[model samples]
Target: MRVKPLYFFTILLLFSSLNNAYAFCGFYVAKASSDLFNQSSQVVMVRDGSRNIVTMSSDFKGNVNEFAMVMPVPTVLKREQIHVTDNKIIEHLDSYSAPRLVEYFDENPCSPPVMYKMMPMAAPAMKSDSATVKKRARSLGVTIEAQYTVGEYDIMLLSAQQSGGLLTWLTEQGYKLPQGADAVVGSYLKQKMKFFVAKVNLKKFNQSGYTRLRPIQIAYDYSRFMLPIRLGTVNSQGQQELFIYALSRQGRIETTNYRTVKLPSEIEIPSYIKTQNKFADFYRDMFRTQVKKQNNKAVFLEYAWDMNWCDPCAADPLSNKELRELGVFWVNEASNKPQISQRRRPPQQGQNVYLSRLHVRYDRHNFPEDLLFQNTANRENFQGRYIIRHAWKGTEQCNAANQYFKSLTKRQNQRAKNLSNLTGWNINDIQKTMQIPQRSASSSNEDMWWKDLWSQ
Candidate 1:
């Protein structure tokens, strides 16, 4: 069977900035996206056993007619296996998984500790004249396995005996194959991989009345759980940012070929981040700093949680229907129905789904191979959670209040230091930005204690 190549779509570096909201736990500030870095791409992969569904969203800003994508497939996909889904699903997934900033306020130390519990949430139709093209392809050692029109895309499944023939054919088809792509194509050919090629059907796209191209979804069964990203790196872009959202039935998914490190989370950050839309910038800078600290050789786990519940939800979890729409085939609606009982219970929070979000800033040097993934039994929940503790500003005359006041300076200084360490920002600049008094360069412990006591 002929397969499509995985290089048809041009990677667009787009980022998303969400509006901030106040949740019961804290304020849900900005969330991070690929836009923080240039040349970013997002992929949502849903896997169960040997079956897999992959949805790819592109930020292509070029003309629709020039839009094309090539994907490597384990098997030739039938027309029914390919689909075009709404972009919102992927956006929702991004928002749900993106690193988030949550803000909290400290209660007055003088006040009684009231224990208040707060809970917070495709294929195109083949033409008869294509028979001549088949004969021509055979002469060139290429096979067109399948062809069909699905939604707004015309897709083809192709298999090649050699890289040269495939490259020649792709070039003739107006694909503008990247330089040095032949070697990579040959490697896939050696592995017996098939290529899936797709191009936008202009007539269909125009008639569909869609302003933007929807994400492309493909379903197949392949035991090798890996994503082919080598072709994307062939471009001269310095570094590409990729966000992979993996959903599995077992538990959290992680990269096996590369180190999968969790991003720093639940740490208190400076409160200035919440004053404006600086949360996204802070996240972006912190991520870059972390990546640099890792020497750009690791994949960062931004979020990994059971779909059932979130401590401080960035966005609501995907519903069963939405999960199914995203190619999560294992979610059975019947099994998810509420149980009728004498006492009505709150609806279920999460189903059997588990999501893992992996962020990587890769280049040809650091990530020389495509990503290989494994679903682990580890179900421990993790999120790129940053905290902002707003200091109590009320004046209450008490011994506790005096101690709280005395520690305020220390806390602010620590916050400044944390922000500096996280984002690689200058300590002086951070203190200036926070409008906190700068500490004397030569101040000693004795001087500081006296300053703290007398200043207050």
Candidate 2:
């Protein structure tokens, strides 16, 4: 009886050693996809039949997890498992409505940050055992990044971007207020503030049909690229508070209620625009700081926004003469709300209706070109003489958008090289190359077209 009990204990110990050496048994990788939100790349995981959990997401636990066929890549499997592998790549569980679970496609995926989740169950023991070596292995930091860029847009929406930018314009013009001081104050403060909303509307759609692709659309795409957002606010005490949100593949999740307050300021608009002293510039600067310092391990950068802090901007105390010329955007004045034609609407509804002139009217010649150009004017102005801020609405469309870390892919770069093969894009005529989408509609326009040789 004593010998039998000892023999049983000895056999169990041997089995346990063998099991530790080999790893997980029976449980398989149920499903895997890339586009799913909240994804991980450092490790794979699965669940056991009796509701026990297993994981592949790990740095060595002083034991080899991969050897146990844990979340093994399809390439490592035998022919019998090929069909299962194909199913994983092609199908998913509860993926349709779950944005986090969809396998996002990217020629280049973001270097998502390392994520660690503890599994509650252990692997079963094996009968055979083998011994090898032991040593110290350095733990590595892992990051994952996924980007959803349907349309192309730049990655940063900074002070260098337009003042009539979505945040600016929306706060300025998008709302209707109750008739009183609270509403007035809200309207006044909103215009100077900034923040990235989860949903963005291409508000200019009705205004620009053939004139150009609406800039709000570009801004929308730009936001999705995990572009940084800056918000400026002011408190009643004339204190400035800037909220900056960083873009990650995950949505902007900040620990503070920094986004909802007002920050007071004593700053001038034109002078402020001239300098990078605007509140939004704070987060914009932080964004440059973060992206410039992104580690090599590509992490999923899903949705990131940034903000800037500020006191309510100082009030303009200019006389009527100065307001008329340098600042025609008179607060005492009203903005004209032009009516739209059916051409602006989509093909489906009310397309047959004739357009109406906007009920509002104002003197175009008296327009504040200076105010509009205070932040928007540039040497890189593409449209004939007029930029987007002020002018007869342009007929030429401007569509500049992008996705992922940067816009230029190896394939895109190759296509760029092959570009000369397909068309007469003369490399020698440096001043006259067209960057598709809005290519030269006329001979003279060719000389004015601009294309950046680089994108991120």
Candidate 3:
């Protein structure tokens, strides 16, 4: 109660400095604040540029005290998925194909059960913002082993008997394969399987027409990962040889590309590219090649916002010029341009005269001026069919569409004559077959399940 003013003031100053200390008393920065390191459990704490201000008592030390490094281990450094640019992602993605199918191998002549599965029905296609995921196939199950991109080189083994019998299985499952298609599928499978068995027996068949490959297991091999690795086939000699791709040190199941061309099975790939650099340059060149404007090729471009403000809607037109350019004629509209209509004027009261002297005149006006018509001459139509996308107000529009398609078969016949050799096919049938289903004109939206049945 009787303390001096100076003594009290000094004590207050000391307490204030203690409470306002910058951080923990010691200057050594913390290595880690918690147990989680590379695992999904992420740790984020305050750091002053150089180090974290993490504090721990002596009791908090154990296996849970795993220190997190700034960067990941060298092995897992490769990003699990690839990084693509904005423009390249959208443009190039559409052009990619699943490299090939998966392969199945056997040991002791089918003693080991051969797991043969296909991915045609694995899952709905992948949907992404930058690109459309056409998932030629999908991994049915997940394990510690992750899946790889479809187009890589890999091998498989199957019982010759099983592969041969699969033709019958395709029929029982209600797949309607054309005679020519069945022949191609069968022959391809048989040849591959035959080479496999031939190598196992070490029987040297005619190596003249045959590309001689000394049978040896590839040291670097990739995993199947549930992809539809090209199902290989056996030959008449009951033998098969498969080319396997080992996963890279970076964990990617990669294949030397077409330019760098590697085949999982004994496929007679025609040589086009000469060197590995040529192979690496192949895709980049391809990306450049596609951007080049080809007068012959016409694509069905779907713009997101222009068609309708709806999310991810395809732009369909009463008449799309691109389709017409490809010789796909859209039934012409009634008139290319709209015209002003003439109307009758109101009759004047108590005005009577001879027929020639009548005061009635036609009241007509030109079409309304709008931005749509602002661009060009009135004789021609608008540059685009600008409207709310999919604006089918009534069944009348749908009925018109139905009627147009009803005669589409007949048009393809006449068009087949005029279609010329532009598409490289003699007729639309081949192109129809070539189309990657669901994108075809004849592809039905009403019942795709039935169409899927027919497609098989």
Candidate 4:
């Protein structure tokens, strides 16, 4: 959907029931949608040295005739430099990087199972105007450098000498900008950036026989590695969600302007989070809580790993052909090697590509500046992973079992606290939901130490 005032960048279930009980291994119950937050957008950027390839996709629900896109770029894109890619790749990338809910059943304190099984379940256009708009555009120093029809989109490369003129020209031409958008546009104009504007070609769109818009991909060789998000914030739709997936030949990509903190992962949470189908709720609350904790100034790193493989994989790595489509020109297209599959080991070396997923909840106040990014040599693997350790269900009792039962209560209590801490939920409510009892001098028969040992 549109993440900005106008339509802007908007941008999967696997069943492998039984899996080896190992680190990062468990059944993925549910995943939270980026749509969980309002005004959300997704962008996939692939970088190698000075070459940058950016793909923009959105779920614009407006009339196809009204769909349009306006973005800033360091250089003008040529016909060859611009392309349209399948939207499925973006979805695959999202699934590969999304935060996951994993559940691990507790082995009986007395006897552990050798194996286990887990089941899995699953842009609008611009306005129109005539020659009078073009004359005004020229007087306003807004020049349309080039125009082409790429796929179902009618694209234009525009260079403007001033922001007010450009904004006026755009307005006359039917592209509406937010009240203060001229300031942001001026900033980009001062940087010698060009505006890449697009609208749907109704005839081409119909002839293409597609249901919706495919992501637009653009490649350019420029030294500035950054994203201009200020325009998106000018409209001020409260806070917006931006998920950026960066693919690089070197290593992890991180925001240089804002603190890039890894989201809390590998933490234990209450079991009911899965049983009650509240994984989405838990994730959304926890994310908001984390944003608050950071004063909403930090960019959260949700996933960072070699693109060649993933452990406790959310989804398979993009195939070579798919990677090429994303503008990873360095990959050997002729290689016959098999595409990376779901695996339980550390990422295999030699893919020469690493992916870093950065999430931000931003508004004009906390994030005044557009995102500035840098690629790092740090290839350490990371993912937003939460755990659910099911309590051992058994009747037989032994010395180990007795201790296990005692520790289990403490563990469950700690889980409740964790949920509270991560999500900002009330501790009492969390405990009540998890059935954690308060410690007291007067206890019920069920609380006695000998109760389970002596009884069947």
| Candidate 3 Cα deviation (angstroms), residue 63 | 49
| Clash count (model 1, backbone only) | 29
- Model 1, 66-131: lDDT tens digits are 667777676677889888999888777776677777766778788854232211210000000688
* Local distance difference test scores for all models: 0.70, 0.17, 0.18, 0.71
When 1 and 3 are scored with lDDT, the better candidate is 1
Q: What is the lDDT of residue 271 in candidate 1?
A: 83
TM-score, candidate 4, is: 0.84
lDDT for model 1 comes to 0.70
Stretches of candidate 2 above 4 Å error?
A: 1-176, 180-255, 258-456
Candidate 3 global lDDT: 0.18
The model with the greater lDDT, 2 or 3, is: 3
Question: Predictions ranked by lDDT, top down?
Answer: 4, 1, 3, 2
Off by over 4 Å in 1: 1-7, 10-38, 113-129, 334-350, 439-456
Which ranges in model 4 have alpha carbons more than 4 Å from their true place?
A: 1-6, 9-38, 112-136, 334-349, 437-456
Q: TM-score of every model?
A: 0.84, 0.12, 0.15, 0.84
Instruction: Find the number of clashing residue pairs for candidate 4.
Output: 13
lDDT digits (tens) for residues 237-346 of candidate 4: 58877777889887898888899999999898998987888877787888899999999999999999887776666667777778898888888786434444445354
Give the alpha carbon lDDT tens digit for every residue of 307-340 in model 3: 1011111111112221112111222323222112
